[model samples]
Target: MSPASPTATSAIADGVTDDALKGLRRWNLGLTVLHAAQAVAILVLGNGFAIAVTSTFPEGPPGADAPAPSSLFEVSISVAIAVFLFLAAADHLVTATVGRGLYESDLRGGINRFRWAEYSISATIMIVLIGFYFGITDITAVVAVIGANVAMILFGWLQERVNPPGRTSTTMLPFWFGTVAGLAPWVAIVINLAGSDGAPGFVIGIFASLGLFFSTFAVNQWLQYRQVGPWKSYAFGEKTYLVLSLVAKSALAWQIFGGSLAG
Candidate 1:
């Protein structure tokens, strides 16, 4: 019997670590693809249908009494979706390239860049929501939309700075705050829908779908905090957070802008 050499033992440990990194990279890439696809789907389905429906409406009379046609909300939503799709695609393309060979430093850099991008986009969304809120006269709906956007912006800022997965301190504050923030968009959507008069069927359906996504995302955040089921690894946890953040914000934007158009 002989003892294993130090170099050989180190090699074995390194091999295991390398394999783990590869797995994480693959997971990240997959999530990125999913995010991009969701953005495209929203644009194609939502905007396509909107254009088709609006085209059916006859042009208004030239007289001053005729209400001017407004497509501002629709255009705003399309632009938002296009921007998000671009960001997701570009970010993930960089991630897929840099993520190779499983270099931790490079991986971390990419993730941090992605987080900053997310933060910027979230802030932009809040601004857009503020504009939409002011455009409408529904007080309750306005408050809910603004509150939800503010909560999400705070959540994004804190999540990036706090790095909950890497911290040992209690995450109770972030956890509860994130949970509420994630649910806020859905609540706002429901409030809007309830107060809406004669909203189109597809519009109602879109709100319902977004509500479900936000609801699921809120639960997933809580579950990740608890480390129940598959939320154990930092890699898995962060990936979930990224995907949910992208989905929730994008969907919320679509809902808010689309709802405004409906009004």
Candidate 2:
């Protein structure tokens, strides 16, 4: 009937937390591998289809009867990226378990800064696909969007739990970026659905969605490193890469949209 000391209570809570995380990690690891395999299979098949379609229909819209690379790549890539994202989510789920259950501190936690880098890069690739889609009308672009969106949501949730912004000026960027990026596509989609097709709604949707995805992705990774200790130590080079990727894609997205309009 003795009252427990605050220190003792904290330790007990930590132990319980650790056990829970361990279970989650085990579950996530298995799921992650499963998702990865599925993604690979899907992408391989989709790419093959793209080759077939491109060869079969080299000019304008496929004759209602002709095969089209556009459709093949679009659908195939979409499925591939979607599967990849599902696999990525397994990382968060697994990492969370590692951080909470296995590691005592941030350094030892399941997801280290490098892991964040990988996630950030993958997210960037997804956003880039959004731009590519505008130009090529292929599955790769669609799948990238799908994968990016899924990763953002899952990782965003993990960020809150494991790397919550601790009232730092620098930390605000990721939260805001993620908030905007995560919401942009949904907003654009709604707007496009309401707007007329010839009104250039698709173009607007593509831009908003891609911009939001990349900007948010950069912010998310920036925030991850910011929490590691000092902002000065954060990876500036990686940020540059992310920024360049976005810039490159933005131009391509615009060009694609322009081509569609001119034709």
Candidate 3:
């Protein structure tokens, strides 16, 4: 089905919210399918780089030469990271576009500045991650990761600086969520810096981080969808923002950590 248009749900959201959701859903089916296809391709191509006959990996430096973990385990891990990178790209594009497109569509809430900041920082992080993945894994990765963290710290400050009246209740969740999500990339970078052998520490840290993120999200979503009191009572904008942020962070953590392991 075609995605819903801007006005389709206008009655529900203040004009601004409706406009944002509409723009987000704009290329819904096509964008989602394309994203999925891209993810699959990256995984397949990435796997091909492996010297080991048992699995796939993208061609690259001796990074791939690192001794294999259990073949199944390594392949599975590689596939997970490839998927993470692709989705991070997709989410960054979609969220930023939605935030902007809403302004273009009739809901200009003094939010463009915030959206721009969010988009810019996110894109920068992705770029750094991309660069690091391609062979610049030493000090350069450290620098990029540090830069990304600084941007996010600034983002948290900017959020409060620009907070608008009436929306505080709703915006708090998303604001914090975004803040935390932005920090997730650094967690992987730090783990990488410590060392790499796909040691149990790295593997456990990656999975544990993911589990914590998703568990929070699933609980939030369940509460919201079930119309539970806690969900309804927590404040509207807050829950939505947090729910979205948690999911994004979990995915981001997965991708970066996966890439580190795969490489």
Best by TM-score: 1
lDDT of 2 by residue, 1-263 (tens): 11221221122211224444455445445545655554454444333221111234445555556554543433334343543355355554555564433322432222244345445555544544443443423454344445556556455445433432222222344355456556554454445445645535565555655565556545545545554443232233223333443344334334333433222
| Superposition-based RMSD of candidate 2 using all C-alpha atoms, in angstroms | 14.7
lDDT of 1 by residue, 1-263 (tens): 11222222111211124455667567657757766776666666554322210121235665435343444224355555556655665666565676353334433322244544554564445434433432332334444555665666566445434432233443447546765665655554556556767666545655555556645645654555566777544455556655766666566656655654333
Q: What TM-score would each prediction reach against the true structure?
A: 0.55, 0.37, 0.31
Each model's lDDT comes to 0.50, 0.43, 0.43
Q: Which 10 consecutive positions of candidate 1 have the poorest summed lDDT?
A: 1-10
In model 1, the clashing pairs are: none
lDDT (10s digit) by residue, model 3, range 150-228? 5654554444334332332333453465557556664664455456555455444544554455345335533543446
Compared to the true structure, candidate 2 yields what TM-score?
Answer: 0.37
> What does the lDDT read for residue 72 in candidate 3?
33
Using lDDT as the measure, the top candidate is 1
lDDT of 3: 0.43
Candidate 2 overall Cα lDDT vs. reference? 0.43
